[model samples]
Target: MTESKADQPDEKARPRRRQARGERRIQQLLDAAASVFCRAGYTSASTNAIAREAGVSPGTLYQFFPNKEAIAVELGERLNRRMLETHGVVFTLENAALPLRELIDAVLDPMIEFNCANPAFLTLLQSSDAPGHFLEEHAALHDSIQDRIGELIGVRNPDLSPERRTHTANMAFALFKAGLGLILGHEGAEREAYVAELKTALYGYLAPVLGTEGVPAQP
Candidate 1:
């Protein structure tokens, strides 16, 4: 007997619909969490506040997350994944031949944009009241970024010994982190000036080791 299209089991479609709804709900919760954390700080943030921000009942939020920490963990994981993706693009062979200034810009621009758009990331990470495990997870992501930056350095400056490359990479990451702080801490002309200065400083530090000479003067 031939079954009508509408009479088919439709098992796959049912799960797909349910999964899509579930994902949408989770996104709502995370978005609300980000806003709440940003405004209230991690310690002051509460599940009830997040639920209100999400426009869902407290029970609904609990269905997706056990507590505020779980919400933070998920958000941190998502941000780390994005950072990895940005680094992957910047550290590729295609970008290895870029001039020192352009290379640093390529790496820093996307990262800075991400940080600016997701201010809660910095807020949650820097808060002393955040869970120890959450901080540890963030630290691990930072280390992964540093390791990849070391690899990129080796690719661009093949003569550098592994130890020297690691040291340089660590220093460069520290500088980049500080640059992020400065950018976030200012606005308008000051932020633009700080960004320019950061690029020049990075170029000067990198040029000697990367064997790139006579790089253009800073703007």
Candidate 2:
């Protein structure tokens, strides 16, 4: 029997809804895996526990991801993407033009917020020794900071050389990562103190490249 044309739209909508459901399932698995990995570490985290946390069967978990490492890799990718999106929203041209200290604070604020809100996320990052092919697979994403900085600098000062742009991006991310380590690995006043030091180090490094005028005047 021939299907009615009217049903075609409904059929298409069904597929979209199913895809959305699948994506949600994958996200749930990742969220649960993040917690399990954080508590147990990568070497000891079990698929059974992750599956239980996700409220899915082991078979269902395997259907979405082959194993724990795949889950870890996907979670890391999502975390990186999420961080970039959060930072991107906060780091506007106006904020970017702020003194290097303020700019660093802007970037670090969301990151620290994310870590505090999702301690499991940081634990997962700290658990692994850095995925070996992580850089290769996520090179574009990892370099997103540099790319955005390069774009902003180009708009502000067209003559900024590629080397200079690259340097600024590299310096900023290095300090950001170091700050993240201190914040995630420390607690209370010590964390606050480290963040202050990190801001100073980051701004001092970028001041030469961005110039005092480009730097945000206030923190």
Model 2 / residue 83 / CA error / Å: 2.7
* True-vs-predicted CA distance for residue 32, candidate 1, Å: 1.0
lDDT on C-alpha atoms for all candidate structures: 0.85, 0.74
Q: Give residue 93's error in model 1 in angstroms.
A: 1.9
Global CA lDDT of candidate 2, please?
A: 0.74
Candidate 2 per-residue C-alpha lDDT over 1-219 given as tens digits, one digit per residue, 9 for 90 to 100: 898887567877889999999999999998898788777776788889999999999999998999887887888777767766786886577776765566667767776787766666556545545465544445665566668766665544557888877776776777777777777777889988887887778778767666656543223
Question: Measured by C-alpha RMSD in angstroms, how accurate is candidate 1?
Answer: 4.4
Candidate 2 Cα misplacement greater than 4 A, ranges: 1-25, 55-60, 115-135, 150-161, 213-219
Cα RMSDs of all predictions?
Answer: 4.4, 5.3
Query: What's the number of clashes in each of the models?
Result: 0, 5
Q: Stretches of candidate 1 above 4 Å error?
A: 1-9, 213-219
